[model samples]
Target: MRSRIVVGVSPSLAGLQALRYAVKVARERGGTVDAVRVWLFRPLWRDTTATFERRVHLAEAELLIPHAFDAAMGGPPTGVKIEPVVLEGLTVQSLVEHAGDDADLLVVGGDRRGSHLLGSGPVTRYSVRHARCPIVVVPPPALAQRQPVDALLRELDREIR
Candidate 1:
């Protein structure tokens, strides 16, 4: 059986980096990549529209797979097999459950921008602490630049505008 490498997928820069790195690992290991997107229903009114909300989120998740793949690698890897999975639940729980204990690896993006800690985002931190398989956190390339404080502050100011 081919080794299973599961990766969390999102549209963010870190998310795309994770997806790209997952594909690289999969190719080297001759494994299939499971690009998983977890969606949740945050209903405003309550459970009355829960079903409809789930469907909408599910559809959005399904569409995200291709878009993420495209943004990450210009398109999915040609030789490696890509399995897109969309699940309904908490992001961390859903990813861990899907990855399972037997998975060869679980890859997640390292997002620390809004995180209280400078290490990893909640998903990455949670997966590292909870996942049965080994976890790989791909840091965003922007962090390598190490922009000066003034430049970073200016960028943040622009974003707020």
Candidate 2:
């Protein structure tokens, strides 16, 4: 009986854009929003903070998710709730698997360059293929519209030379 869209968000700017868009869409559709960010673990990795990383991740998620929820609600709270979920596993697989059975939809931000080589690469591809739910693959910004400062500097250097 839940009527909310689940958005997979991260601390990255791309993920932020997706989260913002999810709120907007939810507001228009008279629904609630759930924000989730997942961190994946590579197998056989040795790290000093591995034991403590989970706790730290949970804390960060608690702080950032609520803030995003509040920001999305805009003011005075319209009962549109934002639930933040922090999970660890295969990035996209964990997220898609953990998604509510009756969720309204699933929203995820996609990289413009299509980072299919990352650890979560296959996970992302699979989730998109078999989510069995409504999915919004937010298109990335145009490269021309977001040229890097380094590119500008290079041009200047070339001109000077």
How accurate locally, in lDDT, is each candidate?
Answer: 0.87, 0.67
Residues 1-161 of candidate 1: C-alpha lDDT, one tens digit per residue: 89899999989888998899999999999999999999887776757478777788789999999999988888878999999998988998899989989999999988735333446677887898899999888877686437768989999999999
Clashing pairs in 1: none
> lDDT tens string, model 2, 84-143?
677776666877876646677888766655544353345456667767677776534455
Q: Which parts of model 1 have CA positions greater than 4 angstroms off?
A: 46-50, 112-118, 143-161
Top-lDDT structure, candidate number: 1
How well does candidate 2 match the true structure in TM-score terms? 0.71
Q: What is the lDDT of residue 7 in candidate 1?
A: 96
Alpha-carbon error at 133 in model 1, in Å?
A: 0.6
